[model samples]
Target: MDQPIWLTFIVAFILMNVLLVGMAYMTLFERKVLAAMQDRVGPNRSGRFGLLQPLADAVKLLGKEDLIPKHADKIIFYFAPLVIFVTAIVRVAVIPFGNQIEIGGQPVALFAADLNVGALFLLAFGSLGVYGIILGAYASANRYSLLGGLRAAAQVVSYEIILGLSLVGVFLLSGSLSVRQIMLQQSAELQVGPLTMPNWFILSQPLAFVLFMIAAVAETNRAPFDMPEAESELISGFHTEYSGFRFSFYFLGEYINMIIVSLFAATLFLGGVDGPGADRYWGLGVLWLVLKVTVFLFFYIWLRGTLPRFRYDQLMGIAWKVLLPLVLLNIIVTAFIRLIGNGQIF
Candidate 1:
């Protein structure tokens, strides 16, 4: 049965809302995680264990005054963050969350949309984010915003080359571009204490995984790679002129973008939501999926806590000189492995 269509949309909407909410709290989680790493106490007053901090923060942002600079381009100014936010969430449609679920006697895939070119689609959507910061800064007409936007565009464009190249190895190994197909291949790879282990691509392609992680962290404009939004120097960077929800939207886009990148990392290298006999056991599948994504989230915070910010020249050099070459080599080596196995050449 094709499902009632309405049910499908409703499920998707609810899932997206949950993801959005979760992304908000992920900020709190990052802070808590960072605090623990640094031997300090994190937020504890907002709620039990500070569980309600994100909500409190959201309320605070909503209550703040909205500001629009008098000299800004009012139209694109308003549209920039929206474009970025929408693109971030919209890309989620193509990624499988926990396989499929039987709801009311119908098996519904847990993704928003399954694209033939799902992985490529995700990459393309990621590229769209560069425009958000670029346009936001450009329209703001502030020197800081404009400079931040330029930095973002350059960073994203440069790092994206490495990002795409890193994935080519996975696509070659799986012989498919669909995210679903890639997950199926990953699921076939492990043996874990009587239970077949989830064959995470991370193990098979360790080099590519490392390269991908570096590129992805850069792509998200995060710490160490956050040259665009350099705080002390640029004064909040691109969103310097933004306030209240307007500022919040940029951040909202950021955390949500983090989720997307983490999930993509999970999907491509972490075997997504697959575990031992997950197809046969409904709950286990969800567990594996969450576990995989959580590992990614943990790594994100760990990097934040452990690594200092990279200088602009150093960042670009790593992206172009180190990462790009490594990615290309991974591709060449993977292609050679495939060819020899197929007896295409010696």
Candidate 2:
């Protein structure tokens, strides 16, 4: 029908496909990096440098037997993976990858939706991720699965508060809840003595950046915080009973969530798509966004390679005792500074 609506649909479709393919390759990339770290050559058989490994794994998974425990709850078990996968995908809708691009003489944003409340929407969907884990564990009718699911729920709950609070500094500085608006605030060039640089929120709010990343890593249940699915003890955790495509759904969900977190962090703290030439060329904006996201993704894999998993008690303690207070202090300090700068306080 209209140009903007049609363009939005097209971009949304393209972005979704790109994210799915990216998530697939991320697994390959992680394996290669991890192997290199551990002094192994990693996958080199399926395709050149194992480029087609993810595809081969997908095909193999598709052909495997789909099994459900005899005593499992049929409905919840059937839908758990789908729930997780869909929720993970939904979180990306509001993420702005690039600025408006000219196509067919009209400008269109490189995002599915541009809601003013994008930040709140991202956090809300993120919180729902644990539901799928809980359902999967309960529906499987397994004790270990249930334990893993409960752990995941608690872990998510603990860190989610810290995650939300950690971003308060960004929201205060940007004065908007929209992710794109937040990036816009950081797109300005700042001058220091004779040097000029992008005024990314990361430079001003280093504390928030660190807190956000720590909580984000915990939120995604990545290494060190991966007690829920600690294979050494939980035997694959909540998805233990899942097999074939069902298991792949959970795997896909995790990688997609990881990508979303990195992208959001890039947008909030690293100035999504903001860099030299980004203002002149929309394509460069996309490139900058991708580069920033790539760095964050590599950081995730690096942490997994080097860090040992945290103990259950230590994990909860870090969230409640350490991150929680730091985030709260960050918020208070940020608010006070903003007030003083605004001449509202002496």
Candidate 3:
């Protein structure tokens, strides 16, 4: 059953704020982590342990002068950043955070909309984000910005195919595209000398997990595959002409996209909200989801600190020649395993 309209609105409003706050802190987390890796002190001036750095950054961005290219398309320039920011925030609606919790003796699901085709919706929305990138670049009236936008579009188009195929193995194993049902299917417990653990897809489809991670990083335009805004090649890439809150919008969108994919990885492969004690306390499930997403987010930061960006040709090669065939094979092999397990094939 669908949630009450009022309740849905309340949940969405709360979740949206949570996402925005999380994105803010993600920057702080990345900076501190990178600083540690490089043997230096990070943002410690704003608040205790630099907890207030994000807020400070937000204030600074807001107070900075908003600039536009003299020859820019005013309407597209104004709306492009908003498009990216809104689309990035909206994809969280279909992700199931936890099973259910009670409030005032009434049971409430932990997600906003439990779409039947949640996976497809994610793909569609993710693809649409490219439009914002392209539009922003074109409206900037800058050659470098256009080149960055083209690279981004090409990278997204290539990686998206592998991203979808990688998840086909999970969908095949779970027999559903709904994120909630997939998590439910993974809820079955395993026993080993009285120790119980959830049966996550990561163990069964390790290859898929690896492929998905790579494709997701590329899709989000992160390091090692962040050819779009590569500082060496294109000065800040597609949003080069944007400043102040306009630039901040694109910045927030990127981090939010990172969070979204991290959540997807957790929910799909790591048995989201399925940690020990989750069954006993619904609130723990939410904590588990958060913990899992945090791990992936940290992993993302770690990669940025550790790995060098890939060359433009190498980026395309990895998507087409490496991840593509591997994911296709994984899907085919998963299907055959399912058929044989069901006694439908020898």
Candidate 4:
């Protein structure tokens, strides 16, 4: 049964606020992790252990002057950041954070909408966000911004293929594209001789898992893969001329993308919301999802602190020459194995 209209609205409202707050603290989380890795204190002055740092940063950005280049295309420049930010937030609509739970004698689903083609929906919307970068760069009327936008277009085009292919194995193994269906399938236990374990796709599709992580990192333009915004070469890339709240929109969009991608990965491969006892308690399921996302978030921060940025050529080459082939191989192998298991081929 469908949830009440009012209930759905409430869930979406709560989810949106949670994501916004999470995106803000993600900055603080990254900084603290990087500081620990670099043997320095980070953001301890704002409020206890700098817990209030995100608020401080928000205030500072709000007070900064908004600037637009005199020669810039005002219309495109005005809407470009909105494109990125809105797409990032909308991508989370289909992600199932937990199973249905009872509320006031009625059952309520945990997601905004249960789309049958959730995976494709994510990929399609994710692809749209690049346009914001491209348009922002072009409208800025700056050579550096143009170069950054070009780099972004090329890099995203290359990695997006690998990212899509990497998920082929997961889709094959689960036999469904609905995020909730995939998570439910993973909740089953697999008996391998004397061993018993949750049947997460990560166990059966390790190659796909690795490929997905790499492609995901590139897709989000983080660390070594962040060629589009390479400060040294392109001077902050597409948004070079953006300032104040407009600039904050791009920054927030990136962090929100990271969170959404992390959550999506947890759902697809980590038995999202399926930890011990989650079956009985929906709240536990939500907690498990949060824990899984936290691990991925930490990995993202660790990469930034540990690895140097890749050269533009190396970034593009790895996506095309390396990840592309591996993901294809993983899909082929997965399909063959499934066929054998089903006795469809000798």
Candidate 5:
């Protein structure tokens, strides 16, 4: 059944606002996690454990002067951050938060959109974010910014291959590119001798899971793989010339991208909204999804706190020489196993 147009709009509006708020808090979350790991207090003075820190930061950024370098391309510099922010927001439309639930006598899907090619939709928008980084860097007209953009371009391109290939095994196993369907496929229970558990793709595709997580970290430009904005080297990378709210745009976009990736990984491998009682209670499914995404977010923070930045050559080498081949091998092995299970191979 088709959803009412107004309903879709309402859902989109709500989800977008939630994402914005979530993006703000994600900074606090990361800071707190990192602080705890480093034996320090983080943002506690703002609002009882720094609950108001994001707001304070937003207010400060808004009040600061928005600076543009003298040599910057005014037009592209103005447009680039929006490209990153908008693309990050757009990717959230396809992530399924939970199963459908009744609302005013009608069943409403817990997601914004349910396209058949939702996974590809996500990937396409994700890839477009690079344009923002590259354009922002070039528009800055600063040597450091330009170098950062160059590194971003190469890193994203290399890791994107591994990221995409890592998911091919999951796609093959579930026989669908729609994330919703893949989550549903994983909802079934699997029996392993005396144990029974949700048939999450991670169990069967452990290699893909590892590869996906690694590529995800790179794809989001998180630490260790955050070569683009290496402060020690590029002095803040692509957004080096941006200040005030303009810089905030890039910051918001990065956190939002992190959230989206965490959600995507959760859905793809952790059975998404799948957990005990999730089928019977949509709220439980939503909770499960949130919990899973939180774990991934913590993992992201953990890596940032623990791992040192990778050298430029090492970053590129790992993506091209290490992750790429492993993902390809995983795809081949998955395909073979699938064929055998389907009685198409001995």
Candidate 6:
């Protein structure tokens, strides 16, 4: 039986809400983890161990005065946040968060829309995110914001290419664009003496994972490569003209993008939603998936806590000179391996 049209809308709405909530608190989680890394208490004042901080922040944003600079283009300034927010929310469709259980004898896919070209869709949307920043920066009429937007556009353009190329190995092997298909493919070959590996993409494609991780970090403008939104230099970057919930939307979009990147990394390379006892117990898959995603998220937070921001020139050089070439070479090797496996001479 096919899912009803209304159900699809409902599911999309619910998942978007869930994504928003998760993104909101993900910031707190990052702070807490980073604090532990540095031997300091992250946040304990708002609520128990800062559990309520995200909520409190939400309240503050709602009650705060909305501001737009006198020089800013009010129309585009207003539109930018919505663009970023909507674009970020739409990409969650292809991700399978858990297993599907039979209900009423209908087999509903665990994910929203497991498109054949899911990975490519992610790349497209990720690049689109840069436009939100670009428009916001241009509309603000602030020199710093404009500069930040330019950096973001350039950074995302270069790194996103590297990011997309990094996943070509998975595309090559799975020969399917569906994310679930990729996970299923990894599951078949995961056996060892006494260890049962979840169908993680990491084992076969470590280089892809590494290159993808580095490019993802830069693409999201996270630490070490976060030249776009460097607080000291850009005065909070492209959204400087934005205030109140508008700024929150941009921040929320950034955080959501971060989670999306982490989830993609987990699903593509870390063998998404798989874990010990995956064969016998269905629940273990979720646990294993969470563990894998947490590892990536921890790495994200750790880098922020440990590394200093990179200069613009150095950041660009690393992406162009180092990451691009490495990812290209990885794809070359992967192609040759695939060709040899298929008994193709070239």
Give lDDT for model 1.
Answer: 0.86
Worst 10 residues of 6 by lDDT: 101-110
lDDT score of residue 256 within candidate 2 = 97
lDDT of 1 at 283: 72
Candidate 3 wrongly placed segments (more than 4 Å): 191-197
- Please provide, for model 1 over 1-346, each residue's C-alpha lDDT reduced to its tens digit, 9 standing for 90 to 100: 3667887797689778978988988999998999999999999998899999999999999999988999999999998988788888888887787666887788877777778899999999999977889999999999999989989988999999999999999998889999988987887757766876557788778999999888888988888788889997899789998898888888988888888888888888988877777878767876787777788888888988888889888998888888888899999999999999899997
**At residue 321, what lDDT does model 6 achieve?**
96
List, residue by residue over 104-194, the lDDT tens digit for candidate 6: 8865555787788888888889889888899999999999999999999999999988999999988987788888778767666567778
lDDT of 5 at 243: 92
Lowest lDDT 10-mer window, candidate 3? Answer: 189-198
Candidate 5: lDDT of 308?
97
Local distance difference test, each candidate: 0.86, 0.92, 0.92, 0.92, 0.92, 0.84
- Worst lDDT run of 10 residues, candidate 5, spans 1-10
Pairs in steric clash, model 1? 190-197
Badly placed stretches (over 4 Å) of model 5 are none
Assess the local accuracy of residue 291 in candidate 2 as a C-alpha lDDT between 0 and 100. 93
- Tens digits of lDDT, candidate 5, 157-254: 89888888999999999999998999999999999999998899999999999999999899889998999999998999998899999999999899
lDDT of 6: 0.84
Q: Report, for all candidates in order, the number of backbone clashes.
A: 1, 0, 0, 0, 0, 1
- The TM-score values for the models, in the order shown, are 0.95, 0.98, 0.97, 0.99, 0.99, 0.94
Please write out the lDDT profile of model 4 over residues 1-346, one tens digit for every residue.
4677998888888899999999999999999999999999988999999999999999999999999999999999999999999999998889998878888879998998889999989999888989889999999999999999999899888888988999999999888988889989999999989999999989999988898899889888899789889998888999899999999999988999999999999999999999999999988899999999999999999999999999888888888888888999999999999999999999
For model 6, what is the alpha-carbon lDDT of residue 28? 92
TM-score of 2: 0.98
